[model samples]
Target: MGIGEGEPHPAGSGSSSVEVVDVLRRGELVVLGRIPSASNATLVCDVVLDDVELRCVYKPVRGEVPLWDFPDGTLAGREVASYLISDALGWGVIPETVLRDGPVGFGMVQRWVDTPDNTDRPHPSAPSELPDGRVDLVDLCPPGAVPVGYRAVLRAFDSIGEPVVLVHADDPRLQRMAVLDVILNNADRKGGHVLEGLDGGVYGIDHGICLHSEDKLRTVLWGWAGETVPAHLVADLADLARRLESPDDDLRSDLAEHITGDEIDALALRTLVIAETTAMPLPPGHRPIPWPPF
Candidate 1:
């Protein structure tokens, strides 16, 4: 969803990343406005710390709608877990997110990111209808709209029977975020959840339906599907795999508070498999891509 109306909130108010994280973990939250969106109830709010205001997204556990596939009341925790994984990889692909008590109860709060205007921003689930009404670009555009070395990862036709090209498999940020989704077993990585910061950082959000033990991965980021994984990415996965296996690892301990032990085991297994194969595995005959791939 597009950002709510009002002045945009700057993310870095001269506070170090550590200090910002601390505020998200302990500050008092004041509701700014409701961001209307499809799937979940997300709120735009201010985290107050010693009179300084930090904008954030607040997702209360009580606001979560029940899903048949996912365990109830765990979405908020999963969001924080996703952030932890991103930090561990040193990818900074997810905005700083933390779990803390809010006005309603415990929930997930993530630092707000600054994105460009609607017309220029790209969404994973949104398609841009060409003026001719013949083609719809799903997460891509004409050659001129993107930079060189951008791979035409997907090709398809719109409803009006026109051809289209889905490019940008070479975007390093997107590539890393896609790998993060796989490791989390993210079941709903919609196009709209990808946000771009003013500083040029790409951030992935809405990870409520992730980290389940079951194989319910669904996303629009299959441009690199079945491609040989890069060595550096594999090394990151290897590190996560080793950490998940260690009994004394704090990450595992932290994750246990949010997900089932079996789910944690499944996450570890996924990391090991991805590292060993060194390739992005294709979906096992199930519906792989999300509908209306943006």
Candidate 2:
């Protein structure tokens, strides 16, 4: 049968979460092209179902290069697990994802989110140090441009040696995603992995290097460090901790199918610590942010 043989709207259309999962699990995958910049081999594809056409990214097991830290042939599985964690917490930060046999072999297939234009929003201008020996906003306005009190948390230089301010994690969407990264123990939460959808939803992706048993939570979202975690978020973490320890929980069983038992236990431990502290984690000091920020 031809791809998307019976669709009026694209893949998601108005489908429920269950329907979306079903389509991702059983739809026809048509590879459109390769995403060359990804560390692992990644493909942009169309998931064609009887009544929907969904854009997706496909990462096959065979395409993964060996990593000394994480087990071989398990990155795709981690990607699916990340989606499950995001869903369980009701954060809605990760796109719908599933694992199935594709053209290359068993791998991860995730819904592709489209980023909307954010030209009207404030963006980074430049960075400078403060009198207190801390780095923060120097100025945001361009020459005579109107100032909006945008604080610069991090700083980097542009292609021609001009400075560019970095994103402040104070943005609500970003703050949520950053907390999710801490829960997942994401070791590679790059700026590019954060997506702003056309519907104004923000999502985090590229979770292949996450959920380690060790304390490897390196990221670019340090703006909330040393701050109190909101009480509601603490409650959510408590719920997650309970779910991780429950024997009959579906999410626990699902994660076991993809990752090691030790890693799951580590997740439980991490959840408890986060809830107990109720504060953003402090940097480990010495090279916490990933290189090539974007």
RMSD of each: 5.6, 7.1
What is the overall TM-score of model 1 with all chains considered together? 0.83
For each candidate in turn, the TM-score is 0.83, 0.85
Candidate 2 lDDT for residue 276: 93
Q: Report the Cα lDDT for candidate 2.
A: 0.79
lDDT of 1 by residue, 1-294 (tens): 223455334346466778889888887798866766556778777787654568788999999999888878989989988888888878888888999889888899999886654334343234444355322212556544544555665567766766766664467788888888999998887666776666777888888989999898987777788988889999999999999999899999988888889999999999899999999978656767666655
Residue pairs with clashing backbones, model 1: 124-191, 124-294, 125-191, 125-294, 126-294, 139-294
Question: Per-residue alpha-carbon lDDT of model 2 for 148-173, expressed as tens digits?
Answer: 43334466666677666665435677
Off by over 4 Å in 2: 1-8, 117-151, 158-161
Candidate 1's error at 11, in angstroms? 5.6
> What value does the lDDT take at residue 82 in candidate 1?
82
Maximum-lDDT candidate: 2
Q: State the lDDT at 89 in candidate 2.
A: 91
